[model samples]
Target: MIQRIQTIFLFLVVVCMGITIGTELWEQAVNGQSWKLSAFAVENLSADGEVVSSSSKWYIGALAAFVGLLALISIFQYKSRGRQMMLNMINSLLMVGLVASVFLTTNGLNSELGMEVAGSYKVGFWVILAAMVCNMLANRFIRKDEALVRSVDRIR
Candidate 1:
């Protein structure tokens, strides 16, 4: 079951979510000010590039961890594709919230620093989006597998 294509996809979903914790989600810089947001922390810098402040944003990290845990759990539910599919859907919704929260928090922080929302999404954003895509792919394959099993049963 672990060798299945959907299993691989599901595993990648977990890996991507886990990686988000260590990566920057968004950033901005203008006129000697810069702000960077990661999963668990946000950094602010003055014009001199000195570390002005850093604050813990634990909720982002916690949500990301929950998403990863769900994907990992889904990978092991190979015997029940229905349950796996449900979990995948839930994971997808969670991922959407995760992305929105990251951007919202970053924008809030950027505004506080008097910088326009000029920065694009960083590597972490892409990774979470990748996980969402993987979850969708895995769900599709799971449905295919269920249909195959039902066809074989009906033939018997």
Candidate 2:
């Protein structure tokens, strides 16, 4: 069961979340001031590359960790395909929240720093989106497995 294609996708979801938790999501330099946004904080960096100040965003990291936990749990629930599908749906919602939280953080930082627009996204942000895609693919494959099981049951 662990060899299922969906399992691989689920594993990838976990990997992406780990990266999201550990890396900076966005970066910008304006008015000679630099800033970096990560799951844990929004940091103002001095010209020499030092953290001048930081505002905490621990909730974003918490949400990402929760989503990753759900994916890992879902991977071990292959016996109950329906439940696995439900978990993935929940993951989808949580992933959306993660994205929204990141966006809101960026907006909040822009306002605080008096910037016209937010900076470009970095690896952490994109990786979460990729995780979402992988989650969707895993769900699709789970559905296919469920349908096949139902068909076989009917034939017996």
Candidate 3:
């Protein structure tokens, strides 16, 4: 039952991510605003500085890819009880990555694109947060399964 819930949650997360991408693209097309790519300076050194930055769109794409991968893994593991536990761990880590990417992209968009794109950022934040909660619940289910297996083994 928990596995089933997790599978559903994963599907929802994928849908949310898709919606986020779609909304952003629609807004850009309707407004006639070109997507801006900007570089952020991570470190400042004398005159020349080392910058580690990615475009707002790139980060959104990355988050979508990560969530999609996790959703696929969840579906694959649905058939097997043992594998679900491992998949849950992977999903949790991916969720963390997704959330972080949302924050990074939100900050980047605010700085590069201004308040005009704030709606997209807000929607992305909520979706990512929901995904995080779902992933954490899935992880808990995995732990519960582990304990159940151990108990059964001991009884036998």
Better of 1 and 2 by TM-score: 2
Q: Compared with the true structure, what per-residue lDDT tens digits does model 2 show for residues 36-155?
A: 988888889888888898888899999999999999999999999999999999999999999999998888778976898778999999999999999999999999999999999999
**Full ranking by lDDT:** 2, 1, 3
Which regions in candidate 3 have their CA more than 4 angstroms from the true location?
Answer: 1-3, 25-56, 79-83, 109-120
Candidate 1: regions farther than 4 A off:
47-49
Report the C-alpha displacement of residue 50, candidate 1, in angstroms.
Answer: 3.1
Identify the superior model by lDDT, candidate 1 or candidate 3. 1
lDDT of 3: 0.55
Error of 3 at 44 (Å): 28
For model 1, how many clashes? 0
User: How many residue pairs clash in model 3?
Assistant: 0
How high is the lDDT of residue 33 in model 1? 72
Measured by lDDT, the strongest candidate is 2
Residue 114 CA error for candidate 2 (Å)? 1.8
Relative to the true structure, candidate 2 has a C-alpha RMSD (angstroms) of: 0.8
